[model samples]
Target: MSHLHIRPKEAGADKRIINITPESANWQFVGFEVVMLEADDTLVVNTQNTELCAVIISGVADVTTQEQLFSNIGHRASAFDGIAPYAVYAPPKQELTINALTSLEVALCRAPAKGLYPVKLITPQDCVTMTRGSGTNLRHIRNIMMDNVDAERLLITEVITPSGHWSSYPPHKHDTDAIPQESALEETYYHKLNPKQGFAFQRVYTDDRSIDETISVEHNSVVTVPKGYHPVGTPHGYELYYLNVMAGPKREWIFHNDPDHAWIVNP
Candidate 1:
């Protein structure tokens, strides 16, 4: 376990209107909110009660929601939902300087409103890359929010396991519901680590009383998922990233494991 969980953009609790709905890890359910904006931040204007989707995990930011006004655009990773008296401007607070650096600290992931889902933007060449075992390497980012096509929870992926590799492999669980094949989903794992450093070993239980718990994640660590049958391990070297929040009732995220390890899913 490398261990890293950094959240210091500075906003302890001045209230100033920050409901989040009640999910935890800085509000985890109505939509999602993993906010962090430094340099000369200003997040006022609640928009009558929250409705935002800000995502720019790097530097440079200047936004003024309610309708318009955006300068410098949304830095690197961009995603902004809608309808809000939103406002975020950061600059020169002391000679803004962050050039060519890889990952030293930068994040702004929020989701409070959007028709109920369907807002995606995954870069890293769209990610499909995967290298197995303990020396794991992976990248899977998804966002299908909701389509209501039956809408139980269609898709939402963000899994990047680099350094030591291995991700929720060989251990699966869907809870129940077997019709077309298998269907059940309820998962949430939000962890981010690059230079923030180490720690990554998560394993939920269920193998006949299996109730194991080991969580030592850093860099905005977050792991909460009621059921069991979870899997995520990256030990050998390090390098791990996570942001795979899911919802279920039945849209499609089938699962069926615990059958003698299911033959390790063959290769």
Candidate 2:
């Protein structure tokens, strides 16, 4: 098992498939988890010293925090349904409760914070949907919680890659704390395939090849990138959807493209 590739845990009553803590990864900044809930089930998130973003990836749920109640926060049944998801962000020292109105799949993204923001619901309309690249490099992106949002240190997004296409293309890295040039952020990719049985591929590597490996990613798999230009690819028939959670010393996203592949973006 490559350090970068992660499979979910065995099914439990709670169905929290993937759980990645910063301590578990030996990387500071990003902590992520995904859970599947049955209708009427409930989950409680205690935010201690970190802020959280609970993304209602699919199905309906009522997400409530001390400061807000985001009721019936989802609609699509699957991540690949072409619908931007509903998410809720809550600050530190609070508890966010999620009660499923229908079967649900939610992602919990966490990062260190100073309690600077209140709980807020991020509607689909608030997300920016855009198409990037052309040809095989083409992909769709939904900015769930990006720079435009007011968060102390979390940048979240979702991407849908068509079958046989590439995403996070032109391989980019943000591992150097160069401010306007590049920001060091640890990232986690939670992936899902349309058919649920198909697989995708992701490569994580640094410029020097010191940390290079290509991973075969199965449905619900997670790939963590601590420092590298990571890119993803889906096979000919399986469309891919992934939720990305990023956080580090800086909250902004400023990545430097791999010099060798820089032309793909420039040309």
Highest TM-score scorer: 2
What is the alpha-carbon RMSD of candidate 1 to the true structure?
16.8
RMSD of model 2 against the true structure = 1.0
* Candidate 2 lDDT: 0.92
**lDDT (Cα, tens digit) per residue for candidate 2, span 1-267:** 998888988759767999899999889999999988999998988988999999999999988788778777799989988989899888999998899999999999999999988888889999989999999999999999996578999999999999999999889999999999999999999999989999999999998899999999999999999999999999999999999999999788999999999998797
Please list the C-alpha lDDT of all candidates, in the order they appear. 0.46, 0.92
* Tens-place lDDT digits, model 1, residues 1-267: 311122323445431112222255332333334545445655543322223333344445455543444545333432211111112322111112222122212332233232342222333233333334443434333332323122223244445666666677777776666756776555556676665676777767766655566666666666655556877776666566665545545556777666767676654
TM-score of each: 0.28, 0.98
Q: Give the poorly placed runs of model 1, Cα more than 4 Å off.
A: 1-30, 44-167, 175-183, 186-191, 196-236, 241-244, 250-255, 258-267
Show how many residue pairs clash in every candidate, following the order shown: 16, 0
